[model samples]
Target chain A: MTTVMVVDDHPMWREAVERDLAARGFEVVATAGDAGSAVRRALAVRPDVVVMDLQLGTGSGVDATRDVVAALPGTRVLVLSASAEQADVLEAVKAGASGYLVKSAGADELADAVTRTAAGDAVFSAGLAGLLLGEYRRLQAGPDPGAPQLTERETEVLKLVSRGLSAKAIAERLVLSHRTVENHVQNTLRKLQLHNRVELTRYAIEHGLTDPDSA
Target chain B: MAGELRQRDLLAPLWRVVVAFRLVAWVLAVAGWFRERDDYPGTAAPVAVLVAMAVWTAVVTVAYSRAAGRRTRVTLLDLGVTVLVLAATVATQPAGAFGEGAPIVTSIWVAGPALAMALARGRDGGVAGAVVVWAAVTFLRGYVGDREVFNLTLLVLTAGLLGYAATITRRAELALREAAAAQAAAQERERLGRAVHDGVLQVLAAVRRRGVDPELTRLAAEQEVALRGLLTTGPEVAVGTADLGTALRLLATPDVDVAGPAEPVELPAHTAAELTAAVREALANTAEHAAGAHAWVSLEPADDEVVVVVRDDGPGIPDGRLPAAAGEGHHGVRSSICGRLADLGGSAVLHTAPGQGTEWELTIPRGTPR
Candidate 1:
């Protein structure tokens, strides 16, 4: 069973989410209410996935996400927050969160997002995908003459990656070997110093590598 | 406070003009003396009397130019000196010198202190300053001539006219101060209205929507009580900048977590308060409508604007719920949340759907928009 830890300030909301995930066959390992303890507990538990909220008492979920991601390479964070603001989504994505889900998401959607996030898929709420894409377009419009260039194949894989396509999916669509797709993804992550596909997607999108026609 | 300073500023130039007029009068007296030198009875030294008038003019000008407030003794001394010089000229000159209508010593210089006194003490000071000068003229000639009486009338009129101007200036300053205070109060009231409309009213509306669900009603009641307390206490008289991060923290509880930048996201106090209030409204909605909702608040400071996001982990608003709510006269989403931002030259965007949680993106630019 996949192990998950929840970090949110509210006890009732935390318990509800824990119950929902537990019923769905995921093992709930631990929970934290504040940012400081969320980091400490997350490090100790090393859960496969962390269901995190952006707001904590005097602490930040984004900071905690960064700390958790830094400490555990295998761990993925799925931000379960109330805010759908583009800046919040961007910050969490930058901090290495694998997915962003608003609190209003159904238990099923949230559970699905958590499982997908653990499996290394980037998930976003309904309209937030468009908002993030718009932000990426704006960022890509800026001048960055010194930015490192990617090869044609790597750029193709990145464009697919930014469209929220999984490595296996990108491999299938491009008729490339799964191993070859994974290699391109790893190389892209290294070049951008990004930890996960989510960050890679953000970078690709920011560099205008994503194709609107393909999406 | 500024109004008082401004009133003094306006009066200061008038004082300068009065001093200049006094100086002009001294020059005219000196010229009249030189042109009529041979007409002197020879009883008084013309040069000595001319020298005294010139020295007094110099002293009066210097005293008036100093930026001192309420120089009562100096003003009194000025009036005293004028009377004494006029009496001395009459005592020294032969009776024949008075046959020509010109009063020899310090002639028109008598009205100088009257203008100063009128500015300093209003009409009363004007009348008193003119009284001493008129008395000297009356004492100099045993019987006052028609021309001398007319000069006395002119002295009193100058005093009265200046005194009235002083009164108007003071009244205008008071009106300006009152208007400023009223504006501040009105601005604060509107901010308080926005806060109430955003937070408390939304909670109450949520309770109304839930309609007799005991648990939801109980939660709504608690919020209603809190809102009532806030309304009764009223908003603080906000001034200067407020830390957006710090103000946001107050909206957090066990269920609600507020995260912000380490650095202060400072905004104008009213804007910060309004923004925080809008965030609180978002939280209140989550608590009231979103079942078992966990909400988060995050602040991001950009180059030109501060972005505040209030998110909740509850079943989100239905697709048409906001418009429906507005149609039903539920203004929490409209006026308190969006209208407040509009007033500040900012924008509020809401993202939510059934089974998805509601989030508010509040963006306020630095400084007030024109």
Candidate 2:
């Protein structure tokens, strides 16, 4: 069984999601209501998948996602949030979240997302694909020479994904194997997360937050 | 009344400086009177005048400190007392004093009323008060000599500059207050939005997910989209342009899904309107012909143009159906969707086949001809 953890501020939502995952045959290892407790519980439980909500009572799911991903490399995060919280969703993805789904998704869709996330596959919703396309465009507009760029094939795959096409459909259209299409989608997110990490390190070093001896 | 109090508070610092000037000038006047005491035929009247000036200075200082006391009537009374003190100079000085160019009994203390008027009313009031003082001095001396000319010029310039400074300070204060008010309103709106998202929107989502009744689910979903749009977008853009992404997002319903970039896709106002109208027509066509069909509208922005793809998973159009419809004078798709794009210096392509579904790709270039 795939071990799962749920983090949300609403008690009702936490229970509903827990019930849904339980019915779907996933082990509900733990749950948390805020960022601090979410991080601590995830560290203790070491679940294979963490379903995160963007809005916490007094803390952010993005910070929790960063801490959990840093502490356990084997775990993956899937954001379950409202469509209006697009900016926060993007930040969570950069903080090492693997997938995003709207809160109104049916139980079957949620189960499928969690299963795929546990299997180490990138789950690209049409909205996340759109955000990634816009992010790459914005970065290319900047003056940085070492900024990340997407291959032509990756851009083509992302455009299809943004148009609400499934991975199987994209594979059939592009004349590639299903695994290759999934890899392309995963590469786009990996590049974004890598770039964010490099930028943060550069910022810390420039501001003298990093000691010279450590460097 | 509140506005009057705020105005007084804004000008309080300038008024303080004016009162300090009056006290320093009064001290100098008293010193001059002591030095010329023996020159006067009788010292009794000079002593009385000096005492009156001292008492009046204290009275006006206390009055100007309060908002109710800083009125036009009080300012006029202050000028009247100043003129009276200037007139006393002629009575207290000897005849030889005028010919010998000795200083007047009021000395520089006469400028106090002009300074007060400048801070109270601004440049015009300052100039008017200075002219009244000049007239009194000229009448008392019976001449406008070099000394009188010099004193009048100094009084007018100083009063005018102080008045200008006070006016600038008051305007700055009003601007700062307006800016702070706008910031506070924005923060309040954001707080309310967060509260609504935490409670109302969450419940709505949960209701839609329950799917107990199709009609209830539709209504709840529609309200959720509307509320989310209201919280996210700002006031509508200006007349010349609009965000196409925002316009298209409004078309989203339970069965219709809209996807676009997080950033705004801006286009000319009329262009965006026509494109939105075209998309609406396309969705309407789907609803009419393909019952139970789910539609997706995706916006893709490129460096040179924007492409909107509207696709529906439904029974596809039969071969040659479009040509036969055009022959039968059915012009819904041709005129509504394709014609709109044609006018925008773009093209619309429709692809369909048996069981393959229908898709319309509409492209509008950024540099379209007016």
Candidate 3:
């Protein structure tokens, strides 16, 4: 069974999600109500997937996601948040979340997302795809020469995804294999994450928060 | 309540400054009377006027401190006292002493009323008060000499400039109050939005996900989408323009998914409305003809054009179905979608097969008609 951890500030929501995931055959290994305990609990249990809520009442879920992903290399984070927080969702993704699912998703959809996340597939919503497309376009328009660029095929696949096409449908339309389509989607996210990491390191070095020799 | 009091007293500091100025000017007048006491024919009238000037200055000082006390009647009374003091200079001075350039009994203290008038009204009132004083000075001197001309010019300039400054300060205060009110309103809205998101929206989403009753689920889903749209909308756009992304997001329902960039996609307000209307028509058609079909609307903003794609995963239109519908006087697709895009100097292309889904690609060029 895929081990899962749920983090939400609302006790009702946390319990409901825990029950639903347990009913769906996933092991409910750990749960937390805020960012601090979330990281601590995730480190203790080392679950296969962490379902994160963006608003934690005390601290940021993005920080928890970064800490959890950094500590456990085998674990993946899937943000289960409200759809309205686009900027926070994007930040969580850059902080190393593998996928996003709105809280309104049914139990079946939630299970499918968790399963795919555990299998290392990029579970994207159309909104996330749109945000990534916009981010890439923004970077292209920026002054940095070393900014990441998407291949033409990746852009095409991302556009289809933004239009609410499933991976299987995108694979059939682009004449690519299903795993290849998933890889393209995953690669886009990986590049964004890599760029974010580089930017953060550069910022740290410039601000003298990190020693250049050690960095 | 504190902000209301502060706003009401925006000019309180200005009035205090004016009072300080009057006290300083009154001291100068007293000094002038003392210095020229030997030059006057009789000291009693000048001494009486000096005492009256002292009493009036204290009265106006106390009166102007409060907002309710700074009235037009007080300002007019102030001007009347200033004129009487200036006229008294004639009785105190020796015969032909004005021709020798002896200073007036009130000296610089005459400027007090002019400044008060300026603060109460504006440039016009300041000029009017200065002119009244200038006329009294001219009558006392019996001629417009170089000294009288110089005094008139100085008084008018001081009153006019101070009046202009007062007007600017009032305008800036009003603008600041407006901006602060707007920011406070926005912050309150954000707080309410957070509360709604934390409590109400969560319950609604849970209800929708439970799917206990189809109608209840549908209502909950619609409210969730509507509330999310309201909370996530960008700041108000400039007049004559609208964020197309926000308009598109409002169309999102359980069966129809709308996606757009995080940044605002602004277009001319008319263009955005027409494009939204066209998309609504397309979604309505999908609901009527393609039962149980899920629709997707995506907004793509490019360099020189905006593209909207509405696709449905229902059974596609067969060959010649569009033309056949047009022939049968059903102009839904012809007039509503395609014709609307055509009028916008854009094009709508439909792609479909018998078993495949239907897709409508609508493109509108930027900076067209408007």
Candidate 4:
């Protein structure tokens, strides 16, 4: 089971998240009330996923995420907030959060989110994910000498993946064998020289080749 | 200080009257001395009379120059000239002329100086000036004539009393105007504050939270910025004078048909802001609960007041539902429409029953200026 942690100032909201994560079969290792305590708990537990609220009682969630991410590189942060405020979204991402979720989301979506986040699959609300990907795409489009470019097949694969297609489905649609589809994906990874699938996904996103919602 | 003196713009006519009156008074007084020179027999007496008239003319011109001039320096100059004119006239007419040893006309010139300071510098300046003149002239009156001391003292008392009274009346009028201005400012602030609270601020705060529409959020931000801009532009926001009908139509145009007189219904800034805010709140409620049905508006302008009515054809508001709506923080109707208009010396009428449509009427006295 993936280890999880939750941090929030409100007791009710904190308990609700703990209950949701527990029901999803993830082991909730700890909870915290403030940014300092969140960082300390995150370091101590080294949970695979840390679900944190943006607004804390005594400190900022962004700062807490930065500290936790620095000390425990294995841990991913999922930001939960009542606000979809643009400043909060941008600031949380800058401070190293992997995902941003608004609390208006239902319980099942939150549970699914924590599960997906622990597996290293990025998650965001529908519109907000587009905003983040758009920003990354804009930054990548800026003049850069060392930026990598994808071949026609790799670009097509990335677009399919962004459209929420699996490899089996992609093979059927591209009229290639499943094995051939896998080889193209592998070649794409090796040529792009990325270590993992997550980096490939991020690259697809940052180049505007894929819509995050498709994932 | 400059704000108080903007009334100098209004005093231009009074300045003209003072100058024209002074010129005529001086010319006639000068002509009288020349025509009656034979009556004096002694050229010295006639020359003294002319010199006295010339000094009076100079002092009156100085008073005119300062129509809104400095109080202290002008008063002192007037006193010096009056003393010189009176003393020179006494030396020439030592026995008597017009049964007077001195022109005592010098005292009459004192009125012109007092009036000049009063109208130009206002009451306090005039009062302070009139008191000094009265004191010095009372001393001069005691010695102005050898035998007419008692009579001259009485004249000094009457002259001082009259000038002082004019000073007090001017002060009272100024105080009334100041009070009116402060009231207008306070009422305008209350109107704008209610507008932001009802329409813009609450939307922004909600958008900051979840469960809010992004389109509404952007609109709220735009409106907040618009309201702030209006404040910096000052209270002269008279794009049009709004009677009850026009005001309602302005609030609900295109989507709502507003009916009323086309005649200009002049409203002070405060009244217009409050009415517009009330209309906005009512329409926002319609949009939220009325399911996008068209609203109808009407204005009724009375001699001293205006009434604005905005009605919507939709799911009618339920009976005895205002209290529940207020409890649910649907404050657009309660605070924005009803309570807001009331603060501006107006009343709001909410007409509805279940499935009968909702009609809102706001009555504001035209004279309230709020």
Backbone atom clashes (below 3 Å) for every candidate = 11, 0, 0, 6
Per-residue lDDT of model 2, residues A54-120, tens digit only? 8888799999999999899999999998676667888999999999987767789899999999999
lDDT of 4 by residue, B214-333 (tens): 666445434433443333212222333433323333342223444343234568656776787787878778888887676655554556767666777788887778889789987767
Candidate 1, B1-370: lDDT as tens digits: 6565644555677678778988898888778776776766563566677678778878878887765633767778888887777766865477755655544656687778888888777888888888777877766666678877898899999887897787677677666765787688777866885676455555564453343686775565445434433333222333466767557645644356554432355677788888888888877777788767777676656668877777776888888889999999988889988999899899999988786577788888886433
List TM-score per model, in order.
0.36, 0.66, 0.69, 0.32
lDDT of 3: 0.86
Report fnat for all candidates as fractions from 0 to 1. Answer: 0.00, 0.33, 0.41, 0.00
lDDT (tens digit, per residue) of candidate 3 on A1-215:
99999999987778778888998899999999999999998999999999999988899999999899889999999999876677788889988999998776778889999999999887898878888887888889899999999999999998999888999999999999998998899999999999998998999999999999998
Predicted structure 3: clash tally:
0
Q: Kindly report which residue stretches of model 4 are placed more than 4 angstroms away from their true locations once superposed.
A: A133-215, B1-370
- Per-residue alpha-carbon lDDT of model 2 for B1-370, expressed as tens digits? 5885466477888888888988998999889878876666777777788888999899999988877787767888999998987787677777756656655777788888888888778887788888888888777777788988998999999988888887788787776775676578778868988898788987887776666898998788778877776666433454468888888878876567777776778889899999999999999988988988878888899889999998888897899998788789989988999999999999999988878778899998887423
lDDT tens per residue, model 1, A1-215? 89999998766567778888898999999999988998898888899999998866559888888888878999999887643233555567667777777554556777898888788766643223333333333344447543344567875665445333457767887999988987765454343324344455667778899974553
Q: How does each model score on lDDT?
A: 0.69, 0.85, 0.86, 0.60
Superposed by TM-score, candidate 1 places the C-alpha of residue A50 at a distance from the truth, in angstroms, of 0.7
Docking category for candidate 2?
acceptable
Worst 10 residues of 3 chain B by lDDT: B231-240
lDDT of 2: 0.85
**By lDDT, is 3 or 4 better?**
3
Return the clash pairs for model 2, or none. none
Q: Rank the candidates by lDDT, best first.
A: 3, 2, 1, 4
Predicted complex 1: DockQ: 0.04
